[model samples]
Every structure is written in structure tokens, then in C-alpha cells.
Target chain A: MTPFSYTRAGDAADAVRLGAFGGAKYLGGGTNLVDLLRETIERPSALVDVAGLPATIEEREDGSLLIGAATRNAALAEHRAVRSHYPVLARAILAGASAQIRNMATVGGNILQRTRCAYFYDDEGSRCNKRSPGQGCDALDGFNRIHAILGASADCVATHPSDMCVALAALDATVHLQGPAGTRRLKLTGLHRLPGTRPDLETALEPGELITAVELPALPAGARSTYRKVRDRASYAFALVSVAAVLEADSGTVREVRLALGGVAPKPWRARKAEDALRGGPATVQAFRAAAESELADAAPLRDNGFKVELAKRTITAVLGDLAGVAA
Target chain B: MAIRINGTETRAPADPRVSLLDLLRETLHLTGTKKGCNQGACGACTVLADGERILSCLALAVQFEGRSITTIEGLAGQDGMHPLQLAFIEHDGFQCGYCTPGQICSAVGMAAELARGAPSAVTTDLGAATVRFTGEEARERMSGNLCRCGAHNGIIAAITQTYAGAAL
Candidate 1:
């Protein structure tokens, strides 16, 4: 790692103030940032350590779960409240990285973790728009197996690699941010930005802003949720295609459903069409297959990743079927 | 920076950029913890903080001030080896032994979690307050600790045999 100055922030204000200085990065967990620094992909002059912030897991009066940004992934997964109430979130965290990485990775760091695009990490020689703006996206044409098929631009096609964020999107989780502009709340679904002309800007978070916490609202009664991740290996590998689903079944009919896909989109791909197909319909495997096909109808897969469409469709069908069984 | 390692409090130069892995191996001379990947991708530098497994490579030395840390060296008692350590030896749970320190420390923490009835992702009943420590459960919990030596079969067998008769 390059030499850099570090200051442990006394409070959120101090973190923001320190971060407002040019070439400053908020250090949470350091699982991703420190690695990037070592590779010279990120060269922040100073690091504002925000790990000591008082933010932690708490239950709201309205019965929603509030997760502090600094809350470690392991803590969040094992929290009694999280395990009982928001199990989808727990499942997502469980499917991520590994036990050791989860212990050091924070919720804020998980959200802010850059894409795992191989080209982006190739510091020696590679064209990556996310790494260096206006350079180019090498993955667009070469070895685009894991590239995004939804909400992608010509500048970049790298898909978001987080399993936790896909569940958050399906649950409509809210991101609570603190910065120089005081406190602000944004929907987690809108947290990521599409790679338009400016592929460099990845998130809605402004410079100097810190993610304070994420709030998960209560789900409807009879809500059954599941997160299914498909990876090359059984463990310790990034997802090839993952699905997060929450379904409400009533008397064998799907009353409501929310679905989101990871590893296939620049952002979490919310299966709005699939959800619409299932709502108020008879819960059946055929219906799930139809819904899954509808969701992937517009997927434009690259040469090598054409199999992803079929794999994702089968994965989604299987997830819906499993949840339907539980509902039954 | 002050930290309590293996029941002893020690101090190091206040270098915030130094990783806890470096502090243990370089500053404290606790060479039991190996560095496979300086990045957090590998669990070769796993250690315990307050009995919880954490990647020391990703952890800053400054963040662990005053916290109790335990490495593989602390596993054995003055008289003999810890039950898990002995079981590992009996089962030949390692080859080359490069990833042993991290694997053993991680298993120590994981075994504790099992005793506490932590539910893993593969747990069938999420509503079950307690989970059984079956071979599958052990493998799922220990999935983070990779052994390039391909001793996973022996490692899993060792942990299973050790905890099989226990309450967990």
C-alpha cells in the first residue's frame, strides 16, 4: 500500500470534514479499499477511519430493523433481531465472501465495494472505464461472461457483485446517509448509478458523505423470502447469477411478490415484470417459469454469457418454486 | 498501539497503516499466522479478537487497541494440545501446514459458534433456535478456511469427530 495519512474520526462530522479534503477516502473495514490502494487502483492521500462510529443494529418503534453502516457483516448476519425478522438479509450476507472477510467487511464497505471486474483490477495494463474514465471497457468485447446485461452502457458493462445489495433492493431497504448536508435518506434501490457517459460516478453518495445506516421496513404478513446464489464454486466465489425473492401467498394464489437479480445487471435488477405476473395469480411452477421467462425476455447476453439467461431463468424458477412450497 | 495478545498486553508504534497481521508477525514475532494473500480474499491470516474470528490482514493494528487477540500459538495448553489441535493431528488434517494456523484458529471460533447454536445458511429450519453440528454443518461453517493441500476431507472429519460427542 502507498504511504497515506490516517485519522480515526471522533464523530460523523469529523469524518465528513476530513473526507471533504481532496483525495480523502472513508475507511470502513478496509477489505476492498486497502486492496485497491495496494494495486494503485485507488490512491487516496488520507483515510478517515469510520469504524468506531456509534452506529449499530437497533429496532425502531415501528418494528423496522436499523443496521448501522459500520455494523460488520458477521454481526448483522448473527444478530438475533436480524435472524428472526429479516432473514433474507441474513441469507444474503451468509452467501457472500467468507467468514473471515465477513468479520472485517462492514455494511457501508459492502455497499461501497467496487465492481469485481477482472479488467478493473488489472493495474498492469487493461482498459476499464470504471478504473480510468474515458479509457475504455475491455470486458465489453473480451470475456464478458460476468458483464451486465441490464442497465448497461457502452462505456462499461461490469455487473455489481454484491449479494447483500440484491436482497436490500427486493426489500426496498432505505439508506440513511450523514454528511456536510446533515442527514438524508435514499432508497437503497436508487443507491447505484447507471454507467452513462460518466462511468466514474458509481453511487448516489456524494464525496464526503458517509452511509450512517440502512433501515429495513417490515414486510407484509405471510411473506416468505429466499436468496439463491449460483457461483462457479460451492463457496468463496462471486455469484454468476443470484436471485432474491419475497412472496406472499394466500389460498394458493400469489397475493404479492418482489424479485431482484444480481450478477446480471449494473445495478440490482428488480424483476418488476415477474412480480406483476405472479401477483393475484395461482401459485404454480408453470406460472413461475412463465414469469421467469418474461423477466429475461429483454436480456441481451454477450457471446460468452448467453448461457446466463437460461441459467438465471432456471434459478429464478427454482427460487420461486421453493418459496411457493414454503407458502403451501 | 496497545493490544492484549494471548492474555498479554503489548504496545507497538502508533502506525495506523500497519495491518494487524503485520503487527503480529513482524512486531510481536507471532510467526504462527502466515500471510498467503495480503488481500482479505484468503483466510491464511485468520485470528481471534474477543473469541471472534477476523481477518487480521484486513484489520488495522490501531483498530484493535486494547482488544484480546488469540492466534494458533495460544491454542495448546502448557501441558498438552487443545482437543481440536490433537484431533487435527490425529486425523492428519493438514499437509504442507501453510494454512494450518489460520484454519485452526478459524475452526476454534467456528466450534464456539456451533456450541452457541448459531444457524448456518444450510440450516433447514430457520425458526429452530438451535442447530445440530453435523458434518454438513461443520463443512459449511469451515468453508472460509481454504486448504490448497486438499486436506479438507481429513479436516472436516477431525472437527466432526471432535465435536460429535459434545453438547453442540
Candidate 2:
């Protein structure tokens, strides 16, 4: 790894100022940042470790969960309020990496985690637009199985590898930020951008912006939500197509449904089209399949990843069906 | 920065980027923690950070300033070996033994979590702190640690026996 000056951020203001000093990266859990550093993908001149910040989870009087950005994944997953109110978030986080990683990774760092694109990690000689702008995308043709199937542009086809963000999307969470300019709040959907013209600009944060906390608005009362991830093996693998379904049915009719897909898009895709089809509709396997197909109709899969369409359709159907009590 | 590892409070070397795995193995001359993937994928570099298991390879030594870290070298007593270590030997839980240190350290942390009533993904009630440790639970929790020697069955056997003994 490259030799860099390490400074501990005394507060959020200090972190932002240090970050604005230029060529400095804020280190949270150091899971992905350290890995990228070792691989020479990221070469920052200095690192500001912000792990000592007050990263605790708290419940407000309004039943909202204000989760500290520095809160570790293990702590968030095991939090009593989070487990009871937003079980989907807990389950999604637990389905990721491993126990050891969950213990190390922070909530903000996990959401800011980079794509697992093989081409992007190829420091030797792979044309990855995300790693280097104006470069060609090798995943468009080579070993494109794990490439994005949605919201992908010609310049890049890398899927966002975050299960927690998918659940946050379904829960309608907002990210609280503190930067040199000021403080602001942005929706989860507005945080991660698509691999459009600027695949390099992955997030909406400014250079010196630091995420302080993540706030989850109260979930739908008595909503049966679950996160189902499909990977090659049972655990320790990235998602092939993960679905976070938050559903509330009334007398066998879908009252409200929120659907988000991971590993299929450059961002945590909120499947509003699918949700529109399922809402107020009969909660059946056929209806679920149609809803999935309706949203996936926009999918322009590559040759190697064409099978993802079918897998996504099946996953959507299965997850919704499980919540709806349908034989899938 | 100084950290308490295996009950000993020690200072780290000069490099700020040195990982906790390297600090323990290379700097402290404690080779109990092994480095496999160097990334977080392989649990071969597992160690306890404040009684919770973490990937030491992915952890910067500077970040662990005043925390208490426990490695495989701290698991046993002066008399013999830790129960988990003894169970591993009895079940032949290793072949080449390259991943044994990390596996044992991870198991130690896992038992602490179970004792604390932490729940896994398979838990039906997410809010229910108490959990039942079954073979399936062990498999899912231990998925981060890979054993190329395929000594998985024996590893499971040792963990299972240890859990049973602890319960008894």
C-alpha cells in the first residue's frame, strides 16, 4: 500500500475541512478503501479516520430510526429497534459479505462501497470507464455475466453491489450529510447515480461531503417485508439478483408494495413500474410474474447476462409470492 | 498508537497503512493470525476486535488505537488448550492447518456472540436476541472463512462439540 499521512477527524467539521484540503479520503471501516489502496486503484495523499465518531443508533419519538453513518453493519443488524421495525434492512445486511466483514464495515462505507466489476479491479489492463473515465468498457463483451442488466449505458455496465442500500431504497430512507458547504438530506435513490455519461461520478456527494447519518422514515404499519438474495452459493458470494420486497396486503389485495432490485442496475433500482402493477391487484403468482415482466421489459441484457432477466423475473415472483402466500 | 492484544498492551510500528493482521504477525511477532486473501473475502485473517470478530487484514492498525484485540494465540491457558482448540484436535478439524488460527479465532468470537444472544439471518424473529446454534447456523456464520483442504466436516464437528460442551 502507498504511504499516506493518517489524521483522526475530531469532528464532522474537521473531517470536511481535512477532506477539502485535497487528495484526502475519509476512512470509515476501511474494508473497500483499504482494499482499493492495496490494489492501487485509489491513491489518496492522506486518510482521515472517522471511526471514533458517535456512531450509535437511536429511535426518535416519531418511531423513526436515525442510524449513524459510522455504525457498523453488525450493530445495525442486531439493533433491537431495527430488527423489530425494519427487519428487511437487518436481513439484507446480514445476507451480505460475512460476520467478520459485517463487524468491520460501517453503514456509510457499505453504501459507498464500490462495484464488484472485475474489469474495474483489473489494474493491469482492463478498459473500465468507472475506474478511468473516457476509457472503454471491457465488461460490455468480456465475461459480462455479472454486468448490469438495468440503468446501464454503453460506457459502463457495472451493477451496484450493496444489499443494505436495496433495503434502504424500499424503506424510503434519507441520507443525512454534513459538508463544508452545509448540511443536507437526500433520498436514497438520489444518492447513487446510474452509469450514464459520467460513470466515474458514482455518488451525488460533493468532494468534501461526509455522510453523518441515515434516517429511515416509519415503515408501513404491519408491512411484511423481506430481502431475498440469489447467489451462486448460499453465502459469502455477491448477489446474482437480490430483491427487497416491502408489501402490505388487505383481504388478498395488494394494498401497497415497494420493490427494489440489487445486482441488476447501476443503482439500487426502485421498481416503481412493478410496484404500480402489483398495487391494488390480486396477490397471485401470475400477477407477480406480470409485474416483474412489466418492469424488466426495459432490461437490455448483454449476451452473457441474458439469463439474468429470467432469474430476476423468478426472484421477483418468488419473493412477492412468499409474502402473498402463493405457491411459487 | 497502542492497542491491547491478547491481554498485552503494545504499540504499533511506524507505518500508518499496516493492517492489523501484519501488525500482529509481522510487527508483534505473533504469527497466529494468517493472511489469505488480504481482502475481506477470506476469513483466514480473522481476529477479535473488542470481543467481536473482524477481518484483521482489512483493518488498519491505526484504527484500532485503544481497542482490545484477541488473536488465536490468546485462546489457551497454561494448563493445556482452549476447549475449541482441543475439540479441533480431537475432530481433526484441519489438514495443512494454514486456516486453523483464523477459524479458531472466528469460532471464539462466534461463541461470544451466541452468548450475547445475537441473531443470524436465519432467525425467524429479528428482534429476538436469543438464538439457537445449529449446524446450519454455524455453516452460514462461518462462510467467510474458506478451507481449501475441505476439512469442513471436521471443523463443523469441532464447533458443534464445543457448543454442546458450553451449553452443558
Candidate 3:
């Protein structure tokens, strides 16, 4: 790892000030950042440790939840309110990573974690556009089984590896930010950008911007939600294709739905088209499959990842059908 | 700031790049914690941070200033080996024994998590106030720590026996 100076931020202002310095990165839990440092993929001159900042999960009187960015992933998953109200978020967190990593990883860090593409991590052999812009992408041609099928540019075909963010996207969560320019908010769906010409520019976050908290608006009283991840093996593996959905049905008719997909896009792919198609429609396996097909209509798969399109569609249908009590 | 390890106040390494695993094994000469994959893939360096299990290899020494860390060496008191350690020996829970320290420490932390109702991926009822420690739960919670020796069956038996009746 490169030699660097580490300073624990006293507050949000102090963290922002120290982080704004060139080549400085905010350290949260150090799960991904530490690995990247050892790999020399990230060579920051200094690290602003923000893991000790506000790590609380506040329940608002209006039924909304305000989760501090520094809150440990385990704590968030174990919170009573989160388990009772937003079971999908808790399940999603528990589904990803081991219990040990979850205990160490923070919410903000989970949101900012980089892709798990082998090409991106092969700093020695492979040329990655995300690792070094204007370079080329190896995943586009080489063993691209896990490459993105949606929202991927020709320059990069990597997919985001977060399972929690997929649930947050379906929950319509809002991320609160504090930076040198003051505070602002961005919807979770809008925070991550597609792998356009510049894959290095991943998030909407400006340099030195700190994620303070993530707020989840109240879910409908009758809505039921769940997250389903399909991987090679159970536990401790990233999702090949995952679905997070919140369904509200009234006497076999879909009232409202929020859906998002993971491991198939550059960012958390919100299936807005499927949600639009499912709303007010009869809740059945056929309807679910049609809605899923509609969402994947524009998916352009790579040579090795064409199977993901069908796998994603089936997983989405199964998850929605299970929620709707429809048997295949 | 100094980090408390095994109830001792040990000064942290000055170099910001030293991981907690390296600090334990290299700096303080506490080699009980093993380093498997330097990255977060393998949890051979699993240790207790404030009673919660964490991968020490992924933790920077400077980031854990003033916190309490408990490794495999810290599990047994002056009163002999920890019960989990004894159970591991009885069940022959290890072959090469490279991943034993991590498995024991991780099981210790897992018992605490289950006692507090921290659910795992295999946990069916998220809304339940308490979780039952079954073989399935142990497998899911310990998935981070990989054992190439294929000693998982015996490891699970030892953990199950040692932590019996821990769940509410």
C-alpha cells in the first residue's frame, strides 16, 4: 500500500475540509478501500476516516426512516424498525457478504463500493476503463460472464456488485450529502450513473461530497416487499441477477409496485417499465413474466452474459409471483 | 492512541498502511491471527472487535485506535482453553489447522450475534425477536471464513456443541 496519512474526522465539516484536499478519500470501515489500497488501484495521499460519524438509525414520527451513513451494515440489518417495516433492506444486507464483513462495513461505504469485475481488479494485466480512463476494457471480450447487459457503454461492461443498493432503489430512498458547498440530497436511483463513455465517473457525488444519511419514505400500509438474489452458490457470493420488489395488491389486482434489478446494469437498474406495466394489472404468473420481459426488452447482452437476460427475467417473475401468491 | 488487545494496551503501528492482521502477527508478535487472503475474501484473520467478529486483514490498524480487539489468544483465560477450543479438539474440527483460530473466534462471535437475535441469510423470520442457532444458521454466518481442508462438518459439530442452549 502507498504511504498515506490517516486522520479521524471530528465532524462532517472537518471530514469535508480534510477530504477536499486533492488525492484524499473518505475512509469508511476500510473494507473495499483497504483492499484497493493494497492493490495500488487507489493511491490517495491522505485518508479522512469518517467511520465514527453519526451512526444512528432514527425513526421519524411520520413513519420514515433516517439511517446514518456511518451506521454499520449489521446494525442496520438488526434494527427492529428496519426488520419490521423494511424487511427487504434487512434481508438484502444479510444476503450479501459474510457476517464478519457486514459487521465491519458501513452503509456509506457499501453505497460507494466499486464494481467486482475481474478485469477492473486486474490492475497488472487487464486494461480497465474504470481503473484508467481512455484505456480499453477487457471484460468486453474476455470471460465476460458477469458483465453488464444493460446501461453499459462500449468502453466498459462492468456491473455494480451491491445488493443493498438494489433494495434502496426499490424503496425510493434519498441520500443526504454534505460537502464543501453545503448540503444537498439525491434520490438513490439517481446517485449512480450508467457506464457511459467515462466509466471512471461512477456516481453523481462531487469530489469531497460526504454521504451523511439515507432516508426512506414511508411505504404504503399494505405493501409487501422482498429481495431475491441468484448466485452460483448460497451465501458470500455476489449476485448474478437479483430482484428487489415492493408489491401492493388489492383482491388480486396490483395497486402499486416498485422494482429494481442488480448485477445486470452499470448501476442499480430500476425496472420502471415493469412497475408501470404491473400496476393496476391482474397479479398472475403470466402477468409477472410479461412485465419482466418488458423490462429486459432493451437489454443488449455480451457474448458470455446472454444467459443473464433470461435468468434475470425468470428471477424477476419468480420473485413477483411468489409475492403475489401465484404458482408457476 | 493505543489499541487494547487481549486486555493489554498495545501501541498501534505508526505506519498507516499496516493492516490490523499484520499489526497483530508482525508488530506485536501475536501470531494467533492468521492471514489467508489479504483481501476480504477469506476470513482467516477473523477477530472480535468490541465482541463483534470482523476480518482483521481488511481493517487498518490506524482506524481502530482505542478500540478493543480480541484474537484467538484472548478467548481462553488463566483457567485453561476455551470450551469451543476443547470442543474443536474433541470433534477433530481441523486437518491442517490453518483456519482453526478464525473458526473458533468466529464461532464465539456468532454465538453472541445469535443470542442478540442478529439474523443470518438463512434466518426465516426476520421479525422474530430471537434466533435459533441451527446448523444451517452456522453455515450461513460462517461463510466468510473458508476452510480448504474440508473440515466444515466437524467444525460445525464443535460449534454446535460448544454453543448449545445459547439461543433464546
Candidate 4:
């Protein structure tokens, strides 16, 4: 780890003031940043710790949720309102990482966590464009069983390894951020970029911008939502193909639906095409499969991860079918 | 202000790079908290901060200023061993005993989370205020703490025997 000074920010303003300088980074729970530091992947000159900021989860009268960015993953998952209203969010957070990690990870940190691609972490040997720009990506030719299948460019094919973001994308959550230029809001789906030419520049945040809170818009009443993650292990593993869906069906026809996918794209893939196809369509397993296929029609897989296309389609179809009360 | 570890006011490490795991084992000599895979993949560095379980290997000692931390050394009381500790011994929950401290601390935190209605991944009812403490829940909750000796059955047995009958 590079020698760096650490300061606990008194507030969001303090965090931004300290973090805006060159060679400075905002420190959340340090679950991911600390590991990156130890690996010498990120060598910031200074760290402004923002973990002590307001960790509140406020339930609004408008049936929305306002979650502080510093709120731990466990607190978010364990909140009664989140479990009752946004069950998909709760299940998604629980399905990720582990109990210990969930306790230490923060919402903002989870959003900003780097890709778990082996080549990105192999700083000693592997040549990664994300690590060193213009240097070739080894995952393109190396063993890339967990590489991206959608929204990937020739420069980078790394997938975002976040289950919570997938659920947040489905929920239409807005991220409230504060930076040198002041406060602004961005849709969660738009916050993460699709690793076009600069996989190093992951999010849309300006330099030294800090995420303050995430606001979830109210979902339709009686809508069913769930998150399903398929992994090699039963627990404590990253998702191979995950789906987060909130569906509202009446009279065997889809009324409204929000769908997102994880572990198969560079960002939390909001399957808007599938949702558009499913709206007003018969809520049947065949229709669900067709919509999934249509959404994944553009998926381009690498050598070792072609199975992800079929797996992602099946998971999306199964989740939608179950939410629609149809036998998958 | 200093980090309170095991009821002791320990000064933070001068170097900001020093992790809480290193501060405990190297500086304070609290070796009971094992360091398995220092990268948070293995829960061998699990410890309690304000009664919530967190990975100490990834935690910087400087960031824990004025926070109360509890390790395996602080788990046992003056009366001798905690009930879970006794249960582990009785149930033969280890072969090499490397991941025992983390497993014990993680289980303690798991019990508190269960009592507070923190659902695990295996939990069926998300809206339920509390979940039943079953063997399946125990296994899933303790999946972070890996035991290479294949003593998971014994560990689950010990945790179940200790927490299953509780009010949670």
C-alpha cells in the first residue's frame, strides 16, 4: 500500500473538500478499497473516510425510501420497510458476499467497487487496460469464464460484480451525489458506464464526487418482486447469472414490470427491451422466454462464457414466470 | 481517542496501512483471532465491532477510533467459557481448530442478527420479523467461516445446540 494520510470527514462537505484534491479518494467501509490498496491497485495520496456520515434509512410518507449512502449493507437488508416493500433489494443484498462482508460494506462502496476480474487484480503480471490504459486486456484471451456477455467493448469485457445494484436498477433508484460543483442526481442505471474505452473510469461521478443517498421510488401496490442469483456454490460466491424483477400482472396479462440482470454485463443491465415486450402481453412462461430471448439477442459472449447467454435467459424467464404466478 | 478492543483502550497504529487484524495479532498480541486468508474471502479475521460482526483484515485500525471491538479473547467471561464455546468443545467442532475463533465470533454475531430479525439468504419469508433458527440457516450464516478440516457438521451442530433453543 502506498503511504497515505487518512482523515475522518466531519460531514459531506468536509468529505468533498478533502476528496476533491488530486490523488484523493473517498473511503467508505474500506471493504473493497482496503483490498485494492493492499494489492497496490489503487494508490491514492490521501483518503477521506466517510463511514461516519448519517447512516439513516428514512421512510417517506409518499411510500418511497431514502437511504443514506453510509448505511451498511446489513442495515439496508435488515430494515423492516425494505424487507416488506422492496423484498428484491433485501434478497439481493443477502445473496451477495457474506454476513461479515455485508456488515462492513457500505452502499456507496458497493456501487463503486471494481470489477472482480482476475486480470484486473493480477497487477504483478497481467496486463489490463483498466489497470493501465492502452495496455491490452488479458481476459480477452485468458480464462474468462466470468467475463462480460453484454454491453462490452473490444477494450474491456469485465462485468460488474454487484447484486444490490441489479435490484436497485430494477427499483428505479436515484443516486444523490455531492461534488465540487454541488449536488446532482443520476439514475442508478445510468450511474455505471458500460466499459467503453476507459474501464478505469467506471461511474459517471465527477472527480471527488461523493454519493450521499439513494432514493427508491414507490412501487405499484401488490407488485411482486424477487432476486435470484445462480452461482457455483450455495453461498459466499459471486453470481454467475442473476435476475431482479418486480412484476405486476392482472387477469393473466402483464400490467407493469421492471427487470434487471447482473453478472452478465459491464453494468447492472436494466432489461428494458424485455420489459417493453412483456407489458400488455400474456403472462405466460412462453411469453417470458420470448421476451428474455429478445433482450439477450445482442449478447456477445467470449470463448468460456457462452453458456451465460442461455443461463441468463432461463433465469430471467423463470423469475418472471414465478412472479406472474405461472409454472415455469 | 483510541479503539477499545476487548475492553482495553488500545492506541491506533501510526501507519494507516495497518489493518485491525494486524493491530490485534501483531501489536496487541491477541492471537486468538486467526488470520486465514487476509483478503476478507475467509472469515478467519471476523470480530465484533459494536456487537456487529465485521472482517478485521479489511478494517483499518485508524478507522475504528473510539469503537468497541470484541475478539475471541474477550468472548469468555470470568465464569470460564461462553456457552457456545462449551458447546463447541462438547460437539467436537474442530480438527485443527484454526477457524474456531472466527466461527465462534461469527456465530455469536449471527445469533444477535437472528434475534433482531436479520434474515439470511436461505430465509424463506422476507417480511417475517424473526426467522426460525434451523440447521440450514446456521449453515448459510456461517458459510463465511470456512473450515478445511470438514468440521462443518460439528460446527453447525454446536451452533444449533447453542442457539436453536433461544427465543429467536
The model with the greatest lDDT is 4
Candidate 1 lDDT? 0.86
lDDT of 4 by residue, B1-168 (tens): 899999999989889999999999999999999999999998999999999999999999999999999999999999999999999999999999999999999999999998888898999999888899888999899999999999999999999999996898
**After superposition, which runs of candidate 3 have C-alpha atoms over 4 Å from their true positions?**
none
Candidate 4, A153-263: lDDT as tens digits: 998999999999999999999999999999999999999998888888888999989999999999999799999999999999999999999999999999999999999
Winner on lDDT (1 vs 3):
3
Please provide, for model 2 over A134-247, each residue's C-alpha lDDT reduced to its tens digit, 9 standing for 90 to 100: 988999989999888999999999999999999999999999999889999999999999878899999999988998899998877868889999999999888989999998
The local distance difference test score of model 2 is 0.90
What DockQ does each prediction reach against the true complex? 0.65, 0.86, 0.94, 0.91
Q: Write the per-residue lDDT of candidate 3 for residues A1-328, one digit (tens) a residue.
A: 8889999999899999999999999999999999999999999999999999999999999999999999999999999999999988998999999989999999999999999999999999999999999999999889999889999999999999999999999999999999989999999999999878999999999999999999999999999999999998988999999999999988999999999999999999999999999999999999999999999999999999999999999999999888888896
lDDT of 2 at B105: 89
Candidate 2 Cα outliers beyond 4 Å, as residue runs: none
Docking class of 3: high
Q: What is the C-alpha RMSD of each candidate to the true structure, in Å?
A: 1.8, 1.2, 0.8, 0.7
Provide the TM-score for each candidate, comma-separated: 0.96, 0.98, 0.99, 0.99
Candidate 3 vs candidate 4: which has greater lDDT?
4
Q: What range of 10 consecutive residues in model 3 chain B has the weakest lDDT sum?
A: B159-168
Sorted into a CAPRI-style docking class, model 1 comes out as: medium
Candidate 1's error at B17, in angstroms?
Answer: 2.9
